[model samples]
Target chain A: MTENRRYRLTAIAVTLPTLMSATAFEAGASEPGLPQLDIATWPSQLFWLVVLFGVGYLVMAKMVTPRIGAVLEKRRQTLDGDLEKARTASSDAAKTRAEYESDLEKARNNAAEFAKQAAMEATKKAEAADAKVARKLADKVASAEAALAKAKTEALANLNDVAAEAAIDAVAALAGIKTTSSQASKTASSIATKLAKQGAN
Target chain B: MSNSEGMHSPVAQFEIKPLVELSLGGYDVSFTNSSLFMLLAIGVSSIFLISAMRRADMVPGRMQGMAEMIYEFVAEMVRSNVGSEGRPYFPFIFTLFVFLLFGNMLGLIPYSYTFTSQIIVTFAMAAFVFVGVTIIALYKHGLHFFSFFVPAGAPKVLIPFLIVIEVISYFVRPVSLSVRLFANMLAGHTMLKVFAGLAVMISGAGGLAMAGSLLPFVALIGLTGLEVLVAALQAYVFTILTCMYLNDALHLH
Candidate 1:
């Protein structure tokens, strides 16, 4: 719409000047054989200017301006496209960098966690194995101690029985050497006493 | 003629008189020498560039190479200032630059009218730029385009005053812009003509004065070269200013 207005304006400008010249020529009336104009007026010049301006403006607006505008628009579009492409590329790079950094952070945290868990598990296994070996040693020591006590008790009982049997055998041998009952008794008593005394001594 | 004929003075001849007498209506609309040269400049540039571009190849011929160079130059200029967004303005700016450059150069031809020497013509061109740039600004920013005059960091107390100043500045742009080109071209050409006229007068006086005439002749030649550079420079300045205005329209700065 604005372009159309300009077309009209240009046509008027051109035609107005044409009319002005026409008026000038008419006024130079003294020249013989000169071509003449039928009308001469300010209003007419104004009208002609409008007409010319309109025609010129339309021609320029329709034909000349468009071609120039198209070329300009193409250049503008190319620049805009470049800027947009740069912006997208920059954002994509930033996104990739953020993703990489986060992934690296997660990987690091996982490694640390796994190490701590593995160390805890190893400590628990070591402590269990130590407890198990200590309990086995305690059991073996208790059994050995019990066997020693039993051997000591059996040795003492054996000593007591052998001493009693020796004494009985000595008494029997003294009796087999005989006499009168009283005499034998007395002698035996005496021998027994003596033996007793020797034993005592 | 004689040294007393001041009309022959290079500076005096640039005095402007409107070619067509302003009136309400007439049937005598026709091209004057100024209009003829103006059309010629546009035609020459268009023909050269369009024909040169017809057989564009990877390895360009001379004409194609020159055309490509111009395209590249303007494209780069737009790209740097207006950025890629301003690429659309390259064709307009390029056409404007070539047309003005050719017009300025062609006016130096003997008996040719210097269109740029006339304030009205230069002002007309400048006004067109001003109007076009304003339209672009309004199209891009709508009514909010007025905010450009406020600036971003200015103190609030100064807003009303600053807006007025900015508006004034905006309106005065075409005047200043037109005068810059018109003044430069007019000054350079007038000086050259005056110096050449001196050389003619001095040589006519004869004897030792003829040797003095060589000085103005030499000065004229040197000034002619300088004028060529100035011509190209003015075209460049004009083109760059247009781009800057477009940039302002696009970015509102």
Candidate 2:
């Protein structure tokens, strides 16, 4: 404990003189009161302030201000110009869009017209082809009927001959009364003509 | 960082210690701590503005952005407060704003003097503004400027009374302007020093008593932050008040 106390004493002894000197050096200003209240210093403060403030004002007014003002002005002009260009470009784009839309509308209408025309043309062609087929079918039916009438006439002429021969043979064999072939053929022909007329009716 | 001499008084920090002695026309114009800080304010602000605008790009960089922001801020203040007729005075107002801003801000640094804390400095600036605004009013309106004092809508009997009140209010502009800034700076700095000294004194007691110093230290921190706000707020107030005065001068009513 004694050794510890002696060590502290030696340390304090070493630092005390230096600390005292530092304290003396650190004393407040020569005039004890508030430096601001001291009127004597006002002259210097005002003078230096005026000098510095004047210089600052001159530098700012003459040099600093105009330069900054120019930059700001130039920036503003550039911005306004860019905005104007954008506006014009947008309007031009709108005009182009309108024109394109109109053109598209016209093209759509034209396409519909063309499609209608093509469809009508196709319908007409089909109608013409249908009429031509109908006409050909009618002609073929008329020709076919004419051939049938001619065949019927020929068949009747044969039937009359055959019937007249049979009738002459029957009369000669059965009743001993022989009829002439021409008269029999004439009778058979009249019967065949009447039958054909009845069948047509 | 001060020793036994200043430890007795918190106001010791405000003492003007002469670094170099100077004289002019039988007057003591010694360059002191206050003058040095004023010089610092002027030099630093000028240099910051100049350097920031050195590359005044249309697309401004950070420093240029700050400089332009301040420029536009003051420009807008003058424009809004005083109108287009105030264009000629923009440069002066701009300088005044920046000067006070820097003075208030620079004084926040440890061991640096706050020149704006001085009554004489703030008074000088306020008086200058008052006189200049008066001169502008007179120049613009001639003798008719006296009409500004008389209440327009009041009775004729109250005219003289109203004029007296108006004149008193008008003259109080400089006093109120200077004192507002001076008192704010002086009070804030004194409070900060007092708390700091309290903390130091408490801690100097040694042992368990040193723990009590924490309270004062925390208060000091809080006060410092408040002081920073006051510094900026005071600068803005001074500049804006100047603008309002200019507005009154330009438009008498």
Candidate 3:
């Protein structure tokens, strides 16, 4: 319906001038010649030309061009702002990442240091325990040596008494003279004492 | 020229009947169909721009898109031809471009008068551009602006001859610019009217001649399309030449 109305309006707009011209022709008007070549129409055409051009130039310069320029400028500013924000955000992320990596590296170094210190402490404790066990073994070796020396002296004394009894029996048998057991024991003891002294020397 | 009896005369279309006869100080400043169409051209351009830019969205709709396209097209022409210093004259160039474009295109409408076909109108515009640019050059460069008519790198003997040629060519700028547009429009419309008249004449004979009329009818259709292109191209030519002239005026070489 709007299309029909628009067409009708256009038809009227186009035909109205033709209809008027036709009526003018019937009213006995002189030939206007070529409208373009008509000298009389030049002044009016020039006049309207100046007027319309002045209006167009003013409107475009004052209103249209400035508005379009402003819109384009606004768009440019918005774009630049968004880009700047993105750049700063990315830089911030990079900074945080660096901080995190450095913190992780420090933590790892701390853990390594702790482990090294623990190993050194454990080695020191083990060395101290080993020294105590070695000292105890040396003390037991010294006591056993002293006990063996005392047992050898007691055995030598018993052998000397047996030798005296044997000597008395032998003298009786060989000499055919019955000597006293006391005398024989004395002699044997004396011999044994001498021998023992020589052995001690 | 007033023979509107059968409405088939090719030349009758150029008649300028007064719509509102007015007189001012013994001058016949009567408003004619030429004035009306010129007014229509202005009105159409204004309405188009106003409506197209009413919303002025960042992402433009169709009308806004067209308006921006025209705006940018003229802006680019000015920038490329006239350079950055030409920025101040952008509005004037843009106005002239749109005005001529609408004037030429609207003339293509059936039963509508084409103001650009008039030599006076085109000459008036060209004279304005010529005078305006010369004034700009004079204001900017003073005495050096006259040096524009002296060709650079000319031998001593050829200097006088070269200057005359340069001066003549410089003065001819307005004439050539106006004639180029006016002639193109006038010829194209006249050819279309002639073919249309042929078709009408042939078909009115009836029977076998009516079938022959189809040939001219087809040619008429083709010419109409060609005329539309010519109209747009002529407008572009006129505008770019104006920019080139402005460039020369500003830069002088």
Candidate 4:
């Protein structure tokens, strides 16, 4: 295609000068007449037209058009590049946001787990303290009951001895008969044993 | 006074006094005012484009902006009318547009010659376009290009008549194209000159004539502004028609 274009351009370029010369020859041979209507000026006018038009065409095709096309092309490319960059940047931002949200979710899960473990440990410690306080109160109650039982037994024995002595004095005063101390003691002991048995029942 | 007076004739403005008369063989190829303005149009177009594109920045300034607008305008016309196949011919079309545009506008200036106003000049350009398009059609499509004259979906009875009409219209392209530009410029400039002359003749009488000249003077001013618009419009019309012709040549239908 380029070769064809070049060939055509060269052909046109070659023909232009030839055309101009041919017209110039016609102009020289003709007589001057009415400026516009005259056949003489036609050749010259046509000649200059070819020359000037050829010059204009060469400048336009070779120089002006390409530069303008380039400018337009550059603008389009720059716009496309900027749009691509923006798309990539937005995608990157979206990825970063996703990662951040996932990290936050992970941190929240860890915090919940730690709180549950701490609560369990605190409940265990409180239960252990309550058991120790209950055991101490039970031991104190048992010892006090033992001391009360021992004192009751000792008071019962003293009461029986005193009862025997009193019974012997009463018999001497009322009946004028004196009983033996051992026999009085034996009687009092029997009475005391019976009372104790009744209390047990 | 006669010599000075002779210069004021309306028709005299169209005279082609030779600036540098030259000959080759028996040919008289003299450079004249017409040639001077043609060169001026060429020089101005070149300079305008070269300077506008010299910077060639992605962001265009005023001059570059103007140049680009014109470029894009013609480009769009070619693209819409002629399609992508017309790409190769863009430079030629663009050059023709700017040349004619400048030629018309320059003619609007006082004492400046409008080369496009000349029948031969406009005809030359139009003939070039017509011949070039026909050649392109012939080269691209070969002898089948002649089928362009046959109307599609026509009844068998009408085909012959239609073909004849189409061929005549095709041959008339250059004539019509040339006459359109030539006649518009010629008529507009001539009208402006006549109106200005009327104003001048009326004012030259002094006294009451000077007061009476006001209407013609105003009309002259209005006509001058209208001429400028017509000049630009005619150039646009010429270029667009050329593009349409190129399209028909390339695409057939």
TM-score of chain B of each: 0.88, 0.96, 0.96, 0.95
| Model 1 ranges off by over 4 Å | A1-201, B1-7, B11-24
DockQ per model, Cα? 0.01, 0.24, 0.25, 0.24
Give one digit per residue, the lDDT tens place, for model 3 in B145-226. Answer: 9888887888989989998999899998998898788777766887788798778888988998899999999999999999
Tell me the tens digit of each residue's lDDT in model 1 across B20-97.
Answer: 543334443333455556667766666676576555444568986676666667777788778878866666676677
What shift in Å separates residue A40 of candidate 1 from its native position after superposition? 14
Where's the lowest-lDDT run of ten residues in candidate 1 chain B?
Answer: B1-10
The predicted structure with the larger lDDT, 1 or 2, is: 2
Q: Which residues of candidate 4, in runs, are more than 4 Å off?
A: A1-34, A86-102, A105-113, A120-201, B1-9
Assess the local accuracy of residue B43 in candidate 3 as a C-alpha lDDT between 0 and 100. 80
TM-score of 3: 0.81
Best by DockQ: 3
Give candidate 2's whole-model lDDT. Answer: 0.85
- Per-residue CA lDDT of candidate 4, range B3-94, in tens? 33222444445656668886656666678788888889888988898798788777789998888888889889899999999898888888
Displacement of residue B155 (Cα, Å) in model 3 is 1.7
Question: Which candidate has the highest TM-score of all?
Answer: 3
| Residue-pair clashes per candidate | 27, 0, 0, 6
Query: Local distance difference test, per candidate?
Result: 0.66, 0.85, 0.80, 0.79
lDDT of 2 by residue, A4-121 (tens): 4444344435332323322232345343334455566778889988998998899889877888899999999999999999999999999999999999999999999999999999
What is the lDDT for A102 in model 3? 100
